[model samples]
Target chain A: MAVEILKENYAGKVLSMTIGVGDRAVTVGGATALPFHSFEGEVGNRPLIAYEVLDTVPEDPPASLQEELESVWDDPVKWAKYCQDEQGARAIALRLVSTDPDGQDASPESAAETVKKVLDAIDIPLVILGCFKEAKDGPVLKAAADAARGCNCLIGKAQEENYKTIAAAATANGHKLIAFSNLDFNLAKQINILLSQADFDINNIVTDPTASALGYGLEYTYSVIERIRAAGLMQNDAMMQPPMFLDLSSVVWKVKEVKASEEDLPEWGDRTERAVHWEAATATSLLMAGAEIMVMTSPRAIQTVEKTIDQLMA
Target chain B: MLLIGERINVITKAQRAAMEARDPKPIQEIAKAQVEAGATMLDINIGPAEDDGPQLMDWIVKTVQEVVQVPLCLDTTNLDAIRAGLKAHNNEWGKPMINSTSGETVRLNTFMPVAAEFQCDIIGLCLSGSGLPADANERCAIAVDIMGKAAEVGLPIENIHLDPLVLMLNGNQEQAMHCINAVEMFQTLNDPPMKTVVGLSNIANTAPMEMKGILTAVFYKMLVDAGLSGAIIDTLEKDFMEVVRTGDPASVYPAEHVEKTMKVMRGEIMYAHSFLEV
Candidate 1:
């Protein structure tokens, strides 16, 4: 049977770019189709997964993950290098966790230094993330954006309230911006619209539909991503068409299933195995739902996710 | 243009009987045949048949998708049935079409989001609370309104198919003409011409035998001229086949392929040429 190719030809195009540089650089591209369904439609590039590095030590990480990152977690640059050199990470996502208000209250200068250190150590595309807290992230991300100037890195987690400063910084520093929004598809679209209306070229924007862990509203995440992709293709909704980025590891790690001890959930089986599976499952699902780039942790879990993606693309 | 084969409706006795018996073989056969007949989609409707509409729609959609690569158009007024069909087939390409809706604000309010969520195309009928428009002007007005509403919800106009509600010859001889005129009007109004279609046999319903043939030909001719892309017509009819052949000026048959297929269909083409060489 001759299949009718459903090609989406639209007025606006989604911006695509690899966040990091050099050997670890992961190429991100956009096709107006669902993930890995080229025969049915068009998907220009396979989803890329980036391993995450924390600027400050995590309060409590699963034993399985701790075992992997124990040696280098103290230094953000070393952690970034470990992800790229040893774990074969396609990109490095440096989370400025120290800037969190309740955390170390690390100054903007410190965050800038961390950004410089990671950039110097790894040449792959870099995604410098702001601390989740809006007030603290404003200054920290500004400093980090300046330090990473002209490296062509992508910096983000720019929310509705703090987008002005972050977008200006990104515009000035020659970096891509990640427009973060709540779980709602419309809100994600609105944020993109807001940015573009402010003269921020949407082609440089990647949307982050705030991720939820496996078994924790993951279906909602899947639906949101799927909706965004459909809007881009079938509806040709310009504002919602940007390549989506999923913060896969942070969401997966924070879930109880990943952190719960063997005694806490006996039926869940081994904690480490379950935790890795949780991350893998969550990341895989997001990829299927049209996540172009993912920021993840756990080298073994990354391996599993990459394998799943290989099979899906195959 | 997406062809949603509207053959599974329980409005027909045979279809109702098939649904009542919980027998999906006939519906599945219809769906498969439509797909083979160049339909990129099949509309499954088991509306209020005492049988499980949702379950039947799901089964047929899945069964059809398993055999045919084309998508299914879930045609039912029942929301549950539509949801069921969506759940049963989860593939991206197999996305279902929510068969129809009128432009009434209340109806659009409910239907638009579902269409968006399911990522399906919708068929918009040109009618409002004033009922089916009596003339082409009113019909075109309703159609434009529906198109605007669809656009407002971010539905690309190409994804919307406008049905101008063809009327039977027995009721009004001019109904077909009105529908054709509306199609032309809609074509001009739409940015990228929206797909226009109708039930081809509707114009002939209860009409005199001679009148049916003449009206069908006239209706089809007007539709063709007005840029009607597709319709739910009887594929078995010689007249319909002729219309399909001449529908578009650009659809010239590939002579070799046509001859081969026609010969095979007639059992004249053989596969044993080498073996029979003496």
Candidate 2:
């Protein structure tokens, strides 16, 4: 199929970037053409997948993912290092889950330690996520952002309430920001506008329109993302123009269908294979719907999704 | 100044009949003609009818979007219709504008979410449940309230266009002056400047026939002087609209001098002058 060159002016232009001290570099912009339409226009770079590594062990990761990270799950730096050094991940996303108020309530210092260790161990780009608890994660993300200063990492889950402080930290430290809004295009545009008003360079902003698992409102998420992309490319709305990031791993890992044992549902296939396919399928769906960056957990799923992207690009 | 075409409404009998028949071809023609006549947006108002409002609105929105590239302001009192219109034409190039709502807490609570849900701009009226204020300060307060509600909903202030309720001048002679002051006050009070508009003909409503020309000219000048960005008026009247487009010069005497030099272009006026000379 011939690709439609959607945005001729902005095609292939890296959104923006900041030079890291050593190898912890990141490029935020690059859309030579629409997502996965490489035949018509230049898709300068393939979509980058960040391997998800959490501060604490995931309560119930799928067996496939758990087995792969077993040797390094105890140490975040080792885990991040293994994903990059061995697994060929383009980026590493460290989820600061400990900062959740209901969870371990980890301090900013701990989050910062994990960030520093990951940045030191791997030269690839870094994406530092918060625990989704605005109050607790706000300060924790700020500390991590400060610790990773000058590395030009992407820090967020910077929601509506706490975006001001998080955006300020990223702007001050020369890093990118992830503006997350619930599954609504208006909220996404509104947050982006608010952040831009606060003097954050829009080029450094990435939108996260909150994804859902395959059987759980995935169609709604797809429509919202597609609308956002259409508004950006067709309407030329600056607020909705940022490349999107779909946090696929979190959405897939938490679902019952992905985590349940095969014996629990006799008709279902192998639990490990089913879960990995679930993550891969969800990530692939998002890619088709214009997700520029995706974060996933299972190594096998990442490989499968990457191969699919390659075929689509070809 | 953006001229939002306001012809497509169910309030008029003709429009209601057209909608009842589900004949959007006439609506599409009206929209096309309005765009040709320089309408920046087509304000679609499908009022409360016995028929399904949302379904009708959806049909109109889709038909209009399919025909024209210009955007449509989904104007309706029915929230369901607004939602349907938004859903049907989700990916249009222009951001649709929600016709209006007063700053009353009830209205804001109801409409702000819809505006946020559809990612469209909205027109805010400078009046509340207490009713339209008589003075500028109170009107500005209402504008501020509406803007505050929009901000609370995380909608940018720029997305709001404030309508400083344009009251007629026939009954109250000082109404036009008060409306002008209200517009100025609202402009000064808004943080991220908002576009101000008024229904141009509203100021002349119920005025004497001979008084309409004078009233429209004076009100147009006053509103323009007070920084009105747009007005809803009949754009078909080329002469009146030309005067408006030309900024309503202080003296037509000097305009006559310029018009005579460009006589061939000024067909009717020049022909009348030639007849008088003959």
TM-scores across all candidates? Answer: 0.53, 0.53
lDDT of 1 by residue, B65-184 (tens): 766677666677777777788788746665566767787888787776677676677778888988778988998888888878776777777767788988764435346567878888
Candidate 1: where is the Cα deviation over 4 Å? Answer: A1-14, A22-24, B1-278
lDDT of 1 by residue, A26-119 (tens): 6676674567766655566778887899987878778878988889999888898888888877788899888887878889998999899889
- Superposition error at A282 for model 2 (Å): 0.8
Query: DockQ of candidate 2?
Result: 0.02
In model 1, what are the clashing residue pairs, if there are any?
Answer: A19-A125, A19-A126, A20-A124, A20-A125, A20-A126, A21-A123, A21-A124, A21-A125
Q: Is the docking of candidate 2 incorrect, acceptable, medium or high quality?
A: incorrect
Give the chain A TM-score for each candidate.
0.94, 0.91
Look at candidate 1 and tell me the lDDT of residue A241: 71
DockQ of 1: 0.01
Residue A66 miss distance in model 1 (angstroms): 1.2
Error of 2 at A39 (Å): 3.9
DockQ of each: 0.01, 0.02
